[model samples]
Target: MYPKMLEVAKSEGNKEAERSFHHANEVEKIHAQLYQKLLDNPGASRETYAYYVCPVCGYTSEKEPPDSCPVCGTKGKMFKKMD
Candidate 1:
């Protein structure tokens, strides 16, 4: 879906749409990889950690948030804590 959207955005010459689709696509790929890693180690001990989500680009991080979001460059203060 993201790839299709990205292509559509590109074809339409919509830079903002293209960027959004591209970022979402890349983030989804990262999420899949993280899920795969967890599946590969089903018996590993789990640790609790606070999660922070970037409101601007949906970037997620455990423990502490980055100084600036790698996805959209949003400031750390803009991130919301996920309870």
Candidate 2:
């Protein structure tokens, strides 16, 4: 998406848009770094149970889920399954 935006900016001769697109790409790289850090050192663990807690919103789901939280976009590693 950033590359596409940059291409559009180039075609439209919009220097500001091009610069903003590059800035967004830089921000994404920083976010990726943060994610990598979390992956490297996931803090703790919880005993698996039937109920699952969403790390982002604290919403509990009765079913096992994938990486993304249904309510708040938290990854599966963030969930704490309750007994």
Top lDDT prediction, candidate number: 1
Give each model a TM-score: 0.78, 0.50
Candidate 2, run of 10 with poorest lDDT: 44-53
Error of 1 at 29 (Å): 2.6
Q: For residues 37-79, what per-residue lDDT tens digits would candidate 2 score against the true structure?
A: 5577677223233757665555555557556765446797788
> Judged by lDDT against the true structure, how good is candidate 1?
0.80
Overall lDDT per candidate, in order of appearance: 0.80, 0.66
Q: List the residue pairs that clash in candidate 1.
A: none
Query: Could you tell me which 10 consecutive residues in candidate 1 have the lowest summed lDDT?
Result: 42-51
Give candidate 1 misplaced runs (Cα > 4 Å): 43-46
